[model samples]
Target: MSEAADQHANAHTFIGAIDQGTTSSRFLIFNSLGEVVVTHQLEFKQIYPQSGWHEHDPNDLVNSVTTCIDGAIEAFERQGHSAKDIKAVGITNQRETTLVWDVRTGEPLYNAIVWTDMRSAELVRNLKKRLGASEINQLCGLPLSTYPSGAKLLWLLENVPKVKEAYEQGNLAFGTVDTWLVYKLNGGARANVFVTDPSNASRTLFMNISSLTYDEQLLDFLRIDRKKIHLPEIVQSSHATAYGSLAVSKLRGTPITGCLGDQSAALVGQKGFTPGLAKNTYGTGCFLLYNCGPKPVISKHGLLTTVAFDFGPGKRMYALEGSIAVAGSSVKFLVDNLGFIKSSSAISALAETVEDNGGVCFVTAFSGLFAPYWVDDARGTIFGITAYTQRGHIARATLEATCFQTKAILDAMEKDSGHKLTELRVDGGMCNSDLTMQIQSDLIGIPVNRPAMRETTALGAAIAAGLAVGVWDSFDDVKNVNTEGSTIFKPLVHEKESAVQFARWEKAVQMSKGWLA
Candidate 1:
């Protein structure tokens, strides 16, 4: 339109967020008011090389992100906005997906070991037998689990020849997916913006929880040479320069100022800034993150301690996190494998055909149980099925599996935090299911709150970038965002019925354990 109109649009620029999740990659453009103006998404491959081993092609992850960004920016331009109107970029990625590459060549030594991979279980078990294994939680806020990157890193160093060679030659560079994306987006070795935020770093079991820096003790415990393997410099979650500028995008040279783990980003997007505020994200996996305040609390229960986010220097917050390995993936299984539903959304309609699970309980342990149980031996199991069972009953049981696991995690979080959550802020693909949300609320006995703009994962990254570039004066400036159109699902089932359902689910879980053993 007019030159003045263009100038005004450029002055009030939008922020971009690259949300690299477990099953898909997305790019979103958000206005200063925390509303998404344009977006694009691309689902990538979920490689299962062998049983219990999950991997991703590093190039596929990078290409998916760049493609999504270009697609989103094209949509933004179609809406009459200039590419230059985008000010800064933020990134939120699936945490603990480990990667190692060459520093000079910028080529990955191995496929990224996904967070769900259980191949490192043996390594973790052996490590636990060593002295001072219990003290690792005090150092890194996490116990020995295959879910963290450290075990995967160790596996790469020991099994992969290229990685081991690079490690010995001091050419190895280690980072989670966020660090890898930032380095690649900034022109790989040319810009070398190799840095990670506290939220992602905390999942590596390397960062000291209190100081927010790498601990030498942890490095030694894992037998990693600090000088040989290059670790990404830890930076603020919302920083101006550490993330560097985008070198390959429609908005090339745009500064990437914000970074967080996917779950932590959802917490930020949901405005869970205050202590005791908690949010559960239902993506390929389900993650329940409880804001525990400034200090970290090592869970005496099964939950892990992690960084919620570090907005700026001295603004770090910690969280008690309970992770479920299967959530939306269960619906995908129903659609793709069983052919019970045509699309992911159809699961709700299919479940509606049945009033209840009809005495069936599906423990969706496709990748095994996580959180308090830590049953890596467990496999997917459906209990109490009979000749009378229908597809609708199976669909209802699949949804109930997610709800039951969420209730168990929330119970653990309540015990660890000494405060019960009044409500759960939710977002992601599965939260669209009214049946699932209602079941979640009833199983947990708390209101399940959903926002009008449910793409909070991308919104969180946008908020981080926007904050870093001064788009919003403070978190307060965007406090009222997504607040108007919200829905709350309260418990409808009686407490006794809920208890009976959970007990049956627990029995199924117990029956599924030790399958791999």
Candidate 2:
């Protein structure tokens, strides 16, 4: 190739983002301008063995990811870009989902436990009673809840026969979905890249957020022996040599240079690089992450302290995270389960048919309440229902449920961070709804900033990979790349009205408590 042709090829070089979310896996290819060239996604099975028990077949997760990567690359090549032009792949995964595999065979011992799985509720309660919540929280920046990986892993070790045997024989390897994907992508046992970044590791309840490494005492408190159960090595979120090479797909041999938990990746993708800048991702669930700078701030309120991202050795950032168990999933429930709408996108129009919730308040604790409440016993509840209630009211209430939960989390975050958040940067599937974004803004009493690029989660992974591979020289180069145009939703409701609505939401939440007890 001539010099000009080589330079043109280099200019067309892309970065790949592997977004392994709760319900689906997506691969997105981005150019230097932060524009997505092509993408592919695949939804997989969500196995519910029992009430509040959620499991994902480990193979399904791996297959969905690999397929998306191949499909996306095919599209990229059809656009006249070389597959080799893709520099590096970054991973952003649903956090706290636990998986165990064999050291020799590279096979999962049991179905991957999803983050929303509450089968670990009893285990969590027991640990809270035995060790108390403060000691663990002080060390690991997490409360004893079903949301953490430690509780899910404990449930597996005690209940699953094969997993227990693996542990006893010292052949078990434990990892969150991110680590599992990395391991499988790098040819598993052949060239196992068994590693996790600080963002994913912090959700395990074994990592000290300040030190950004696994805490031995915290592991001991959870009865997890580091020697018996193999844990992935803690690595930087964006490192030159950490995540390892992709040994499969059209982009085989591409280095995987960046990793972040899904919500943390969204935060980074939103360019929430400054402290106190908060972003809420409205995905299968809603996650509000507030950048808390370098030091970890233990939440006095019921928020989680987690690693936001660690770009390199000393570039680690901590965050206050609020997890809502149901958000877009509530919309999916209305469409798929209740037939309230034809599709998830039609929810906004269905909801718009009703001027308000018509006195109804929905507490969508599908699994349980997370962040600031920590109520594992709370089930989904709809209150203030009367004979005059209509489907539109129910639909409005369903969407409002997410907005109310966002408000609750914002209140808790303010209490924990000692400052009111001026605005919230938002992305994901549900952010496409103007009504929902307006409701979020009105309820939170702040502006909701939605980027022109809705795929910030994938963009976040791409940014990390691009940074590691020198696609962009520094943060400044990419800071304003895709941020030129944005839609901002300002609060339209009066403070008193929002407060009254929030009070009703709180009452519904309180009523929803102990339903599963």
Candidate 3:
């Protein structure tokens, strides 16, 4: 046998991670050292049925995931590793992308309502006026907003006839992307493995952050008939058999284990296990999560409290999260919508054409501002535009929008947690740009740490799965998994300059408010 094959045979078995994200589905195979061995990603269609509405066809989500799994497994086998070498699979997905399906037939009653969808704006507004609405954040760690899965579910229940009929008949199965993917990945109606980790459940606003279970008062407030709709059973983030094995893939029958919402998984992947450690993920949207240790710390700022992860009894942790509604998607807008660049990769180069923003500031609140400023009525706005403002300045400002939000979130985290962050670990597509990372570092006045392996989100799922199945015994065993080839960007701009720039951003945000209202 080849030396490499012999080494693979003797080494610990691989772990597979199914990352079901907003824009794509990816299957990645990771080794014990947290190195990605093989990966396959497929971008599925994003459906926009109306203004401010976003969706995904249920089949597209399932089919794309299965295809990626099969493809990644094929690549792994080509490298002389058998599918049997993959001992377990973990799932990390876009949180709060809500879906409803028939329990009997496993057919979707309506398209999956994306977390970014604003169709529930009016519903959330009215819900905020209801009695006891003010107490929801204290109870569930989330305010009444269109971002939660519960809000989206309510919208479907009130608007979609099929969804309403399924709910009334007690045939409705409601879940976020994680639960739906797990149900479908385990053969849908056949095996019927319906469960969700605390991380995902926390985003639904139905689960109590402290108890980590469905709250009756929350149900009453949302007006959801618990008897009429079936919710996924809450489970540990990492468990040996809670998540069923893959039923239809080359790696069929592999035990499925760890699961976390995408942001939480990124935190795990970055090894943000200690309190005050934080990570920012710049995906379709930007999310900054600060680990607040074991107990939940309710945010005095506009941030939301969420489960960081629930590995088991004594390992549960919570996070203070700041969510930004737009990030890398704004770059896509420049490429696809405005034709400022040929593709997203060209954004940095275009922005580099200008030394600075040149007095331009982009709010990029396409869906509305979230976290620290929950301005639901705000719209995307640009300030200080002039003939001197070229595409580069706009591009620079576009990237700055996310950085500015991260700084704002960090400030909020400091106030809420009473601990200042010294550094930030970053991942996702946007973090690849040097200019972007430097901008982020300068804006936050902290070192921006980027791991050589940017696939921390997938690695996080692999870590969870590995932990459950004994591939790794504990967090300490995987602490040094992806520590090599790290790069840290230190702040270059003076703190005063950064503060002045941030002040301008705050002014723009204030001026941009209530545009929709």
Candidate 4:
């Protein structure tokens, strides 16, 4: 064989990951070594029809994913690799973003209700007063809040005319982003491959977390007629033929073998397979997930119990999750809404210009506070602002808001799990800011470890896909993946000082309550 042919024969096989998030859709191809080979990302429009309402055109999602896959495959071919060199693809998406479409036409009945949207607040409030309301969290591992897809679906069925009509006609199909992506990528109505994994299903409040299936009592309590709407079949997170294949693209016919919610994918990407391991992802929203072994731990605090992942029957794990409703989006608010800087990347620079928060503390409850608080009545409140406050002060306070919430979550996790995390594995956009991370480490009083490869979320989906297709035999086989070039930020302030700072944040949180009331 010629040298070119020899090189081609020795080329590495790759796995592609579709990371559909709140703000963007991304496709990343990774080699067996967990190193990124080629990647493409596309940001789509974020629609806010009114205050506390967020929606995404369903077409934007599918189109962005299709474009990203095509773009990444083109780049992969430009290298010495062929499209055939790519094996199965995986999907990780923003959980609880609800959608309903016609079962026959495959057209969306309404815009995708974003996971952070609060239009269902009134519905959720009434749900808490209904019979069997107290059993919801125990059965589904989620509280009756606007955060779950079931509440969103209920709101749509009651409010949207088209959605109501579809439900009454028995043509409504309910799904999170994962199920929709799978259905569309596999030829939509032609293939009709509608399924979701346990991680995604657990967030819907429609699935029984223990049995990993749809619960009758939950449906009855929510007043959803099971016969009226079609829910996606729950499947394993890693499987060979469950998710089907891409129907049109350069990589058409590639099987989708793995699926996870974005935060669960990050945990897997960080190699947090063992109990007591934890990871925090600083995305559009901040999420801290601590592994809690096979069985779920119902939280006494406001933390949520959820399925971490389900590789197969004996390979499932659970997590205690603390979700912050705002993180990187808060930074975006400064850049776009307040014009504090040119872009999000400039936040750390602007914050570093100030020595401290200058007595300002921003409670970022634009929608409401989530996790350990669940204070739906609170609005975004800034405390201690005076004539001395500058843009830098506000910027620092904005960054501190996320850190403070993270600290509260960690404390709650410790109380629920009876285990203190030694260090935190961190990834996502906000983790790129060294100053913010240092502040996080100081307030949390633990090391914040960030890998050089920050796309752990995508890598996680790739890992799941690769596992099903024999790229790696077991979890142990991939232990060394993505373990190099890590930066660890440790505490620099005294313990007393950190406690005082957190106390002030708690005071601000308490004071921020009742604005929505």
Candidate 5:
């Protein structure tokens, strides 16, 4: 909608982005210019009990949506825009986190299995022995790992009595986070869109990459029966359906036009449409996505060939992704867990207090190293912590951990796509730190570009929704509207020093591996 038309008639409107992620839920209101008029966010609770178990209250996820939406809506009107002017909603969520709820009552059968949860590791290990990781990885474009939803679902069906009972009685409905959030946001118990997109489905280890549908053999392998569980209907990422009307807020008839896994949305938000384009999001964890165009190039170097996005049923794009389990959270760990720093911002100042890492390397594998270094048994380790080391060196090492892991993923991206990364577009909480961005550029030897809008996750969703509803024309138009400002950080570290740092990182990685044992 044009600004002039929007003023004359609140007839045409703004786009709403419902970004439900691993740690928080956010609502962002954006205009045709991709400028965020109003936004509200709430961090949800994360439960960790047993070593590898992670869970979330379904009600918490649901309530956060209502709360954040109301907050954002009020702020929108304060900014002279009507909440009623919102024409459509877009959903981008953490992918492969599975939830099972009753089809009739909408009550959750069990705590939602978080994507970071690894209690299913043993189950996946057994599955690997049975199916072989290579064959499963080839078929699904995903490794036979606990990170995928299929194994987690299988684990739930086997261990959780309520979930098993519901599944057996055919009253269970299964969905990833996006499906669950959309279902609840639209209409809790009655919502029947039981479906998943190809992008999210590809991470499940149950969907075939080429067919973009659940494979019968894979379902058989996971022991899931069609009669037992109501699976959501697969849909395109950019469809104008999936969700409509939320019960709590007395909201109805708002068409949800776009959906994507959070990482893919970041890729799109960064304008990574062409092949060789790549973007890395530094959130709770870091995710690097490299656009590989149409064909799926299965990763040979312990990476994943995930669906970049299903533009629609007629159009599909694919990418190779390398995921790191801990990035910004490492800084949180230093502040909250280790008590080394007072706050997140203190990290850069503390790091700069030291000339370098001072022979320390902190591998922030609180869970495990993901992507090319999938050491499932690995846990957090602080290497080279000699008596000479100070808090500043530790902070520098912690920050360097994120940069080193990112570089590894970038190398894997090069190997998979056969194109070296010339530049990287970055967005997220940590990307705001110039010290970190400089290190990122130095390590990758590429200019690290940052857009003016760090809320690109939400903006990406809004853009997709606007395009679907004909509020925007083409990529060129969205480009003009969305990517308004950009800044670039060029590499500053010497090439030889960078190489030495990388080599020391490799040594530390070797030392850190298998620490969980």
Candidate 6:
């Protein structure tokens, strides 16, 4: 493959991509042209104590990244490729989630406030009521709901004395997962590049949509003392003078080149370089992002304006994102929590065993809802369950969770962009389930295209770095080395079937509303 021109395809240089996601950490090696030569993945812990709260040990994230790096080098050696050939590294991570850590000791001051955590639900509602929804929506390209990081950060400062004290003493540094990884990967507070990009920073609720930088007004509104806290310097997502080098690895001196929130990275990996190009990633959660060129579109519906990634010296590209808080997480709920399924792969078989949901619909508001409806009080409400319902029916409904959520988000994006998407480019762990893909296609009444490698997140980061370093010039040059996998799911069910299913889901949504009261 000529992903990049052959001039840069010689054996001396390769790119390493570290894709740190919500549930796992992975290291992938890409050749000069833009191909995944080797990859290693490790899943981490997800802690759920009280309802609407989620947590992750920051050390686990560090360990997982290190392990994947080492394991991937070993895999590369087995494949007869030299890990030393690596010239740079690209990092893609889950965004909006906040991490507050000690600037001196390098230890996380608190468990990471995961993006899915809804502890700030009340604060969000209060803020929305205080600041009109129309103003909040138009200004931030988002709704005044619980899904943002600003309210979560405020809750921590008021409640966690340790974090507040650290902030008061000017020893606190806050960041999303990307900043956390770059810190730990390069030696934490001692020897790391503690910086983030517009792509990730835009979601923090601190950044101004127009300036693409943190705003003074929002800071005042949040009452954050700039002198007491450390905010990572925002930079281009594709360059950072290389994040030092990785120790205890074969790919030492490999410049860390790219950084994007996972969803935006997926858009890059899917080659969504133009307007109207969109991708839906079905991971622990499902996220739909539509590229809206360089200009950001504030949403009338519940959508977030985000930077896809600033390529280089050019203006940062903007996108409208609709996030589904629970997609594959529903499957995890079934297998790991409910004990209804033994393995994740079994979910597809279980879902296929039933022709339909059999009057069952699981809202998975287990935490709350996201996208079009930011209902935080809503809890998981599985309705229309009849005596004949079995695991198969529940399994089908679980798969439907992704389909229904995707449909809602697509509608929101459509309203925001004033353009109807022709088809959806799908990737992530859940897209492997053919049944889910079919359901997604039927619900949208369009074709769903799945890439061959399915590791678009990692690949996206790689492309970002590759482009920045001239490993590839222009998006078209990457096509040669780009290897695409295909599995297109076309709508099979009738239009009325889709309408019927949507109505049932809407009722469940209504029943689950006003949960906080």
Candidate 1 backbone collisions, by pair: none
Q: Relative to the unseen true structure, what is the C-alpha lDDT of residue 231 in candidate 2, on a scale of 0 to 100?
A: 91
Residue lDDT tens for model 6, 1-517 = 6835545544346788898888889999887655678889999998977877888898888789889999999988897877666767899998878889889898888898888888887777677666444465555565666667777788889889999999999998999998888877777767857888878888887788777777776776667877888998888888747455565355655678788889999999888877889999999888998999888888778778888888865536788888888888889889988999899889999988888889998898877888878777788888888889999999999989879989988988888788898889999888989999999999988899987778888888988887778877787876655554578889998989898889889888989877666
lDDT of 2 at 445: 88
Q: Write the per-residue lDDT of candidate 1 for residues 223-285, one digit (tens) a residue.
A: 888989899999899988889998997879899999999999999999888799999999899
Per-candidate TM-scores read: 0.97, 0.97, 0.98, 0.98, 0.95, 0.95
Q: Write the per-residue lDDT of candidate 2 for residues 1-517, one digit (tens) a residue.
A: 9978855664587899999998999999988777889999999999998988899999999999999999998888788878888889999999999999998889999999999999988888788888445598888888889998888889888888999999989999999999999999999988878999999999999898788778888888887888898999998889877888988888888999899999999988998877989999999999999999889999998999999988875567899999899999999999889988899999999889888999988899989899889998999988989998999999999989988988888998998889999989999889999999999999988899999988888888888888898997777877876787899999999999999999989988898999774
Root-mean-square deviation (CA) per prediction: 2.6, 2.3, 2.0, 2.4, 2.2, 2.3
Candidate 5 displacement at residue 55 in angstroms: 1.1
Worst 10 residues of 3 by lDDT: 4-13
Residue-wise lDDT of candidate 3 within 1-517, one digit each (tens)?
A: 9978855653556999999999999999998888899999999999999989999998999899999999998898899888998989999999989999999989998899999999999999999999999999999999889999999998998999989998889999999988998898899998899999999999998999999999999999988889999999999999999999888878789989999999999999999987888999999899999999999999999999999999987799999999999999999999999989999998999999999999999999999899989989999999999989899999999999999999999999999988889999999999989999999999899899999999999999999999998888988988888999999999999999999999999999999988884
Number of clashes in every candidate structure?
0, 0, 0, 0, 4, 5
Error of 5 at 133 (Å): 4.0
- lDDT order, best first, reads 4, 3, 1, 2, 5, 6
Candidate closer to the true structure by lDDT (higher is better), 3 or 5: 3
- How far in Å is the alpha carbon of 59 misplaced in model 3? 1.0
Error of 5 at 83 (Å): 1.7
Please report how far candidate 2 places residue 344 from its true position, in Å.
0.5
lDDT of 1 at 184: 96
lDDT of each: 0.90, 0.90, 0.93, 0.94, 0.83, 0.82
Q: Which stretches of candidate 3 lie over 4 Å from their true place?
A: 1-12
Task: Report the C-alpha lDDT of model 5 over 1-517, residue by residue, as the tens digit.
Answer: 8888764443235888989988899998887777777789999899988877889998888889879988888877787867678988888888878899999998888889899898887777788777445477778888788788888889988898999899889998888988888788767777655666777888887788878888887777777897888888778788765555455552356788888889988887877766788889999889999989888899999889988877764357889999998888889988998899889978899999988889998888877889889888878888887889999999988888999999998888888778898899999988988888999899989899999888877877877777788777666766665565688999998989899999988888888777554
- TM-score, candidate 1, is 0.97
Q: What is the lDDT of residue 34 in candidate 6?
A: 58
Candidate with the larger lDDT of 1 and 5:
1
